[model samples]
Target chain A: MSPFLRATLTIAAKDLRSEFRTKEAFNASLSFSVVILVLFSFAFDPTSEQMQAISGGLLWLVFSFASALSLNRSFARELQNDCLDALVSAPIPVAAIFLGKALANYFLLILVEITALAVFALFYDTHFAAQLWPILLVIALGTWGMTVIGTTFSALTVNLRMREVMLPTLVYPMLVPALMAAMTLTTDLMNGIPLGGDNLLWLRVLTGFDFIYTLLAMVFIDIVVVG
Target chain B: MRDRIMYVLATLSAALLTWNLYKIFMILPDEKNQGAIYRIVYMHVPSIFTGFTGFFVALAASALYLITKDLKYDAFAAAVTEVSLAFASIVLATGMIWGRIIWGIWWAWDARLTTMLVCWLIYFGYVMLRRAIDEPTQRARLSAVVSVFGCVDIMIVYKSIEWWRTQHPAPVLSVRDGGGMGPGMESPIYWNWLAFMCLASILVMVRMRQESISREIDSLRRMAHAY
Candidate 1:
């Protein structure tokens, strides 16, 4: 395998193994997402129509927050053991490190999203008959975009003086476009809208955003880490 | 000595701003359709223009700092970022108020508003990034990168909002159409723009001087401690 792919996978496997051992980040993210879902359930009127009306937004909200929460902690572990310094000093490419962290974050986000969707379906009577695969694809692309940018910001902020508060402050605003696109797609899928027209337009927008931002992160990650 | 000069410039800028405000409210002709709320255009237009000016100044200063490795240029960039953030805040506030009067709603996710908000948030993150980092070189380099990224993100925000659906009308002041504003309105708007540019320049100059003085004081203190 190429150095980039090997480095990315190695770091990703390390994070996944470490997370599996402690389970702190994953558990916290999952629990927080559930709590957010419960709160949304209580806040909105319990009518099926109202529940369906907001399910997409609620899912994206939970996923966004939960992803931030997980990404913030992902670096904390590395920092605690001077692992980041070691990684920085190593011969591996910095973009691989960023990609590895992002992939780990993507995995965590997918888990949180799946759990949230399950809860949403149970409570809101949401049906996913034909558009399920397409919706999942959108979520995958959107989440990858969010995690790429989120991991970069989180890594930068984690080394700062006010790591806890500054990470989300830096991450949330930049995530708006991805969140908006994800919500739009999710809503379209839930509403059973045809995927070929305006929905495709939004999907294309989401894909375009993912492409641009991911490329940006790749180009800049080395500079950010080393600097 | 520099303080005195800054004070004099600030006073002159303030005076000019007051005169321009008077011209906008008392002397300018009312729009045929927009009526009195159109008066907000004076504040709104100037604030937006000044905000953009501040953003470009920040970008230029950041680039200069990176090239020169000069602390003075970093201070200049930070000053520009601060003033730009202030102008962006004013633009957002005035825009919202204007939207309330014109659109019958307090807030709308239109192209202009969304892009401006995103732009403001990016710089806000930039400022926070600087605050969180304690090392001078790291802070300067990181924030410079962030500022450049912010400029690119601003362009993306502007383009995405335009290409996608949004409530905001197309540009009212495009050069392609021989300028969109009528002759009567253009004169006062131009005057207001000049006034705001002066004001923004004065603010940034004052801020840069203050930061430089503070840095000098800090270095002196460090020397005393070492001795």
Candidate 2:
């Protein structure tokens, strides 16, 4: 295998192994998401038609916050054992480190999201039809964009005091467009709109955003890591 | 002395501002639709221009800092970003008031407002990023990368608004085609924009000087402790 791929997978495997051993990050994010969803359920009249109308938005909100939790711990874990400095000294590309962390975080986020979906379905009488695939597609692309951007910022802020609070404050606002696109697309899909025309236009926007931001993050990762 | 030069610039800025305000209120004609309230445009448009100007200045300073490895340029960039954020907050507040008068709502997720908010938030993140990192080199380099990315993000935010075709008013002030403003309205708006730009420049310079002196004091204290 090429050095880049080898290094990327190595770092990713290390993170996965460690996370599997402790389950600290994953458990926290998953439980926090459930608590948020429950709060949303109580805060709004779950029986109101308005709840159904806004379920997609509420789902995205849960995912956004939960993903933030995972993103923070993704890098913070590396710092806990002085592993980040060791990783930096490795003879591998820094972009690989970013990619590896992002991939792992993406996997964990998907797991959390799926579990949240199951809970959302049970708590609310929302219907899901053949539109599941497109909704999932939007979620995948949206999460990719979110994770890439979030990983970069998390790495940038990892060494700071109060990073746990600062990371979300810094990352969430930048994720607005992705979140907006995801919510809009998911809402339409839930309403059973055909996945064409304006809906496709939104999907294309999300796709373009993912491509551009990922590339941007890759190019700038060196500045973030080395600095 | 540097203080004298700054004071002269400040006096010029104040004089130009006074003249511009007089022209906007006394000389400019009332709009057919907006009546006297349209006058808010004088402040709104100029503030937005100053905000963009401050961002570009930050971008240039960031680039210079990265190229030269100079802490002074980094301080300059950060200072400009801070002032720009202040200007953006004013723009947002004034825009909301104007929107309330015209659109009958306190907030609308229109293209211009939405994009402006995103742009503001990104720089807000930029400022917080600087505050989070303590090492000067790390702070300078990371902030440089951020400022550069932020400049590009601003463009994306602006273009997304146009592409999505949301309810924000179309750009009423573009250099292309001289912004299509009537001569009656154009002159005062142009003058006010110039005055605001000058005011923004003065604020950035003062802030930059303070940052440089603070850094010097910090370094001297560190040296004293080492002895």
Q: Best DockQ goes to which candidate?
A: 2
Best by TM-score: 2
CAPRI level of candidate 2: medium
lDDT scores in order: 0.80, 0.83
Candidates 1 onward: DockQ, in order: 0.61, 0.68
lDDT of 1 by residue, B84-125 (tens): 899889888888887888898888977567867888888998
lDDT of 2 by residue, B1-227 (tens): 87787788788888988987887778878887788888888888778888888899899999898789888888889988998899899899998998899999989987668878888988998888888778899889988987887787777676785568778666676575456556678667777778777777788778978887888899999999999
lDDT by residue (A34-83, candidate 2, tens digit) is 99988986798998878767877888999999988888877777776798
TM-score values for chain B across all models: 0.90, 0.93
Q: Which candidate comes out best when scored by lDDT?
A: 2
**Candidate 2 C-alpha error for residue A116, in Å:** 1.4
Output the worst ten-in-a-row residue range by lDDT, candidate 2 chain A.
A121-130
Clash list (residue pairs), candidate 2: none
